[model samples]
Target: MLNIRLASSMVSGVAGELLAAEAQTHHLRSTCSTSVSTLSSLESELESLLSKTHAIDGVTNQISSLALDTRILSLNATIEAAHAGEAGAGFAVVANAVRDLSRETAKATSTIFDHLQAVLSAVDRVQKVHEQLREQMLELDRESGVLAVRVKEQGEIVSTAVRFVDEAIDAATTPCAQAQNAPPASDTYALAPADDDYALAPADDDYGLAPVGDDYGLAPVDDDYGLAPVDEDDPYALASDEADEPPDSESMDDPYALEAV
Candidate 1:
């Protein structure tokens, strides 16, 4: 039977340790999943970016070469038309017009190509930046979530500890209050506000409170044992009857017994 009890205790301890370790592992896995997803997305984006960049370079170069060739051909045609005699005179103007048109078109194409390349470069840079920012955002969000979970867990643990401390304190103080040997928790409890205008009575004898004499000029006390306002003429004070008294009980019966009759 002893061995069984020991085995059960060991098993419970091991199970608790395993459960804690598993929770830690689960949290780690959650972080890893976010990281892995980010990395995967980044890798795929980079691959697409590399392919697009290669294609853009090749297409831009080819278009540039084509424009250059067209300009050269237009120039040669004008030269040939100029070398011919009067019979080619009419053709010469046409050829010159063709050359001018070619130059204009080539300039337009080159300008367009430059602007297009610039736009493409800008887009690529922006996309790369966006991808990086997205990865960072994902990482931050995941981290924040993990931190929030940890904070919540800590708060719960702290709340549980406080509750346990309160219960234990209440249990330890039970005996004291029962035998009237010490002040009760109720004494420590804040006095409730009276619904009526009448003053609230102090704790009574049943609550282990002492009897008040005529000098019981009740004063307001706070949780920190600080005094608030009070009426000096008020008949209620906290004086007890156990203190020194005169020989005859009837002599002290008057509310103003101590005062000159």
Candidate 2:
């Protein structure tokens, strides 16, 4: 019984520990799932930013094409001014300014395009890194989920063990409890009857032998030592006043009483 009780306690403790571990495992699984989701969102945003950055390439290319067209138009204007000679000098100066402006615009567009390319590259790297991290988080989440399931199963087993131990403890101690609460042997003896038809002797008063004024039936000792006188009121007395009387005259006539007189 003691061993059973101890086992019950140990099993209960194990169940408690298992429950705590199961809760922790579930929490870890949830955390991993959330992290995976956040990483996925971040990766998606990075991808979107990378696509937008690439889209800017088309705008940069159009600006570069417009700058080249402007330079070509400025060259045509300079040629026309040359055909006009001294009368087109101011026009040639304007054309020269326009050509320089177009050159500067093209340089600026090239610089912007290079910066956009660098941004796109950086975004792509970030997206790839996030994707990898998301995959790792997904793996961690799956493992955590499996661990949580195992922990939960173990907890259930421990709980079952604890319940079984408790039932065993109860079964082990039930008889003992009844024994402790039971009546004593002496009480059983008191309630039982004697084996034979026997009974206890009555008290002295029940035998008609009670002392009267401290003198039982015994008389005082004297000379001749005669029989003790009986109490006339006693129901068991054998002597009476008639035994001391002489025979009547009628009895003298009878042969048996006269003895052949």
Most TM-score-accurate candidate: 2
Give each model's whole-structure lDDT.
0.57, 0.73
In model 1, the Cα lDDT at residue 247 comes to 25
Candidate 2 lDDT score relative to the true structure: 0.73
The parts of candidate 1 lying over 4 Å away from their true place are 1-66, 169-261
Give the TM-score of each candidate. Answer: 0.41, 0.68
- Scanning candidate 1 in windows of ten residues, the lowest lDDT window is 223-232
> Candidate 1 clash total?
6
Q: Write the per-residue lDDT of candidate 1 for residues 1-261, one digit (tens) a residue.
A: 355445545555554555565476567657766776776777677668767766866776676677677668767776777788777777778777766766676676677667767766776776678678766766776775676566556656655655555566567668767878745456433443333234354433222222332234343333232221122343333223332332244433545534321
Q: How well does model 1 score by local distance difference test?
A: 0.57
Candidate 2 lDDT by residue in tens digits, 178-247: 9999997543223222322232223322333334222444434332322222332342333223334333
